[model samples]
Target: MKHQTERQAWMEILAKSSVVNIERQVQTLGKLPEYSFLRSPEIGLTMLRGRAGGTGEVFNLGEMTITRCVVKILDTIGFGYVGGRSKRHAELAAVCDGLLQQNEWSFTVQNQVIQPLQTIIQQKQEQQQRQTEATKVEFFTMLRGE
Candidate 1:
């Protein structure tokens, strides 16, 4: 259960990270351990949904392109599902995912790859929010008519 939670957290990070960033992080691990693909990376579509007004009603938003794969490293199996058409990114993410499940590599991956990617994501989001906030418009009720 504990491992599941940690896996979910890292998966979320991997899902959001760019292809280049994820690929780069995986490369930093030097020579990767032996892994066999249980499911080769493949492209697919996922149905997206959204709420009417944040919480009012749910509706089909659209379909999104995604690539996913399953891989085995020793006894552990790792899954990777990421957006877009980057097959290599999906493969690398799966490899990293398998490594992360092992206690021997979990600490290193969490500290090096997952956490750093998360920080990069957070900074990008914050910068976007600031840019959006800067464009806010204000209106006054009483003007020339008064």
Candidate 2:
């Protein structure tokens, strides 16, 4: 397996992050540079696939709604694809993606935006895990008349 690049990791984090959290963190950036929409936010549907039992044959489960956008900041282009039909979320994600590619803003965005978003995701996952663990059932076998 190949390791993901830093950009890939951050992009994944952005995609998984909630729009509310993203907007909150991005607000701290103060001012943002001007950008043009290469592809304005558009809503569409993508085929969702699934396996029978995690290892079985793949099949089309259904279609899921998605929003995608593309933005150009200076010479760099950013792309965002997110679940549901939130155009604002898609635009913000694209802006973050473009900013992350710039050397001047990369470090600041990494520290302020990416890290916090990743932490939030981890915390949520941990909380969900704890909740699930609480409902786990244990099975035991006992000898009867041996």
Candidate 3:
């Protein structure tokens, strides 16, 4: 159970790390087979330039490039590189790329990996909601030094 807790914690971290909308990501992920595994989408930051008042002024805003890999963990058949261009990103894609293909990892991947990943994702969202609710503030005036 504790290992499950730890695994859930990591999944939560990975889920929160991406800028891609998590619910949409999960929904899209659910459409795939149960044993399938999707790597955490890679996201990158970019600079965009814009002008104010019809080109009277210019400014820059940061943007992100997001890439996701969807794979059948059973067949190890999946595609990588949906968004950003980073070697590390590509390497992460590659690990998923390879594991998704191998048959030997199937059971271990499904039980130890994918199921826990989904569970943690759900747990993290609930924890976030609880934290947000806990922070709600109420104001009141108090009698002096009572």
Candidate 4:
């Protein structure tokens, strides 16, 4: 597997993170640094696109509720876009993103937040794959002797 850049990894973590999980983790980080919201957390709708049966025609699935925010920590800017309508989640994600950009907190945040979240996400995916594979069906046919 190709090595993932720091920014890319954090982006994934922020996107996939659970609202409660993120809230809890961020709470443990103690007081936040001085920062301002470039954009306050706001809920919006985004078009969801889907491919039929994973190989068929593409179609509009539906509209999904999304919350987004942007924050600036010192000279660095960070953004968060999360699925669902939780404003708090978006805010925390934005804050965490900004913290992750800072050199002083990057390694600590990576080990405490991003790394553990990645592990949890990986485990969930593996469990899902196992469950799906367990339900697989195989068909076979045997020739009859004439």
Give each model a TM-score. 0.88, 0.91, 0.35, 0.83
Error of 3 at 114 (Å): 2.1
lDDT of 4 by residue, 2-103 (tens): 999878778778788898787777766777789898999999999999999988999999999999999998778889888999988888788888888888
Model 4, residue 81: C-alpha shift (Å): 0.3
- Any runs in candidate 4 off by more than 4 Å, and if so which? 1-5, 51-59, 142-146
Query: Candidate 2 or 4, higher TM-score?
Result: 2
On TM-score, the leading prediction is 2
Residue 72, candidate 4: C-alpha displacement in angstroms: 1.7
**Tens digit of per-residue lDDT, candidate 3, span 32-136:** 343444554455555667788767688775666645545454545544453454434433333334443456643454454445556666788899999999999
RMSD, candidate 3, Å = 12.3
Candidate numbers, best lDDT first, in rank order: 2, 1, 4, 3
Better of 3 and 4 by lDDT: 4
Instruction: Rank by TM-score, highest first.
Output: 2, 1, 4, 3
Clashes of 4: 0
* Candidate 1 per-residue C-alpha lDDT over 48-130 given as tens digits, one digit per residue, 9 for 90 to 100: 99999989899999999999989998678988899998888788788778889998888888878999999999999999999
Q: Evaluate model 4: give its lDDT.
A: 0.85
Each model's number of backbone clashes?
0, 0, 3, 0
Best by lDDT: 2
Q: Which 10 consecutive residues of model 1 have the lowest summed lDDT? A: 1-10
